[model samples]
Target: MTGACRRARELVSDACARWHLPELVAPASVVLTELVGNVVRHAGTPMQVTLTLRRPYLQVAVTDGSRRDIRPVPAPDVRAEGGRGLLLVRELARRWGIAPLGDGKVVWALLPAA
Candidate 1:
């Protein structure tokens, strides 16, 4: 989990730099970390992370080999450590959703681009 989260952060940071959108590095890192962490904890299967710049928004997608749907639940307790991944994504991303894939699903978040 630690390694995957670190790598996800690096990937988002690098992608922000490569795309010349340094302003998005922090939020992107947070969103990717939460998404990838969720995949690591729940999916327990091979997954892929994709970063794309789509004009007015930057899209972050994590595809995991699990057919189950992911719904962001409100944190039951504010002090709890768990169950806040999707909530963070929901708060940060302008728009986010999960799309069903043939064998699994792609959880995606879109952050507004300046």
Candidate 2:
């Protein structure tokens, strides 16, 4: 999981640099990490991370081999140690959602890149 987050962050950082949207590197990395973390904790399946430049937004998504529904908790129990990752992602990203695919689902977040 750590390695996956590392590589995914590197990919997001590299993409931001290539696109000259350096300001997005940090938040984008965090959002990507949370998205990846969700898969590691719940899906436990091979995942695909994608970073897409959509003009003013950077679309970060993780496609996992689990078809289960993934939803963010508005306000997780304060005493709980886990389950706040998606909440963090929701707070950081401008917009985020999940899409069901044939064999799995794609969780994505759109962060302001401009």
Please count the clashing residue pairs in each candidate, in the order shown: 0, 0
Show the colliding residue pairs in model 1: none
- Model 1 segments beyond 4 Å from truth? none
Which residue segments of model 2 deviate by more than 4 Å?
Answer: none
Candidate 2 residue-wise lDDT at 94: 93
TM-score of 1: 0.94
Q: Considering only N, C-alpha and C atoms within 3 Å, which residue pairs clash in candidate 2?
A: none
RMSD list, candidates in order: 1.1, 1.0
| Model 1 agreement with the true structure over 1-114: per-residue lDDT tens digits | 999999999999998988899999999999999999989999999999999999799999999999987765766687876787788899999999999999999999999888
* Per-residue accuracy of model 2 over 39-101 as CA lDDT, tens digit each: 998999999999999978999999999998976477898898887888889899999999999
